[model samples]
Target: MSCPICGAEQQTKYRPFCSKRCSDLDLAKWLNGSYAIPAEAAAEEEEWNEADRSSTEPRH
Candidate 1:
């Protein structure tokens, strides 16, 4: 199998990735929201906004 990130041959240690650098790069993508699905993220954001608005309203 080949590395998904760089297309290099897969290494035994990394399994799917060729090296630590590529593995770390993939992780950084996740940590920084590079892998976020747009529809899900938008729904989550809308939920947060609605919650914030409800919290700020004066109580009856």
Candidate 2:
């Protein structure tokens, strides 16, 4: 198989990526949100916000 990042032949150690550099590059993309799965907007955004606000408010 070829590397997904650089199209080089995949190494045995890195089956999907040819080298550690390519593997780390892919990880960085994920960590930085360069790759994302599509999602529909939540139908209850207001309710969710209210719950979050209530949780953070001081109890008194």
Candidate 3:
């Protein structure tokens, strides 16, 4: 099959990518939020907001 990253023919070890370089590139994209979707669920947003608030607020 063709590699999704570079459109090259995929190697046997990297079925969806051409080689280790393409695979690492895809992983870097994922880790840096390049592939993220906008807006999570309301509950998740609420949770994130709570965490942010806690981090910024002073201890009692």
Q: Which candidate is the best by lDDT?
A: 1
What order do you get sorting by lDDT, best first? Answer: 1, 2, 3
| Cα RMSD of predicted structure 2 | 5.0
Report, for every candidate in turn, its global Cα lDDT versus the true structure. Answer: 0.93, 0.92, 0.92
Candidate 2 lDDT at 29 equals 100
Candidate 3 residue runs with Cα over 4 Å from true position: 40-60
Query: Can you tell me which runs of candidate 1 are displaced by over 4 Å?
Result: 40-60
Ranking by TM-score: 2, 1, 3
lDDT of 1 by residue, 4-52 (tens): 9999999999989999999999999999989976566878999999999
TM-score: model 3 vs. ground truth = 0.61
Lowest lDDT block of 10, candidate 3: 36-45
| Better TM-score candidate (1, 3) | 1
> Which segments of candidate 2 are over 4 A away from where they belong?
43-60
Q: Candidate 2 on 1-60: residue-level lDDT in tens? A: 899999999999987899999999999999999999976556577779889999999999
lDDT of 1: 0.93
Instruction: List, residue by residue over 2-52, the lDDT tens digit for candidate 3.
Output: 999999999999878999999999999999989977675988989999999
Estimate TM-scores for all models.
0.63, 0.67, 0.61
Q: Which 10 consecutive positions of candidate 2 have the poorest summed lDDT? A: 38-47
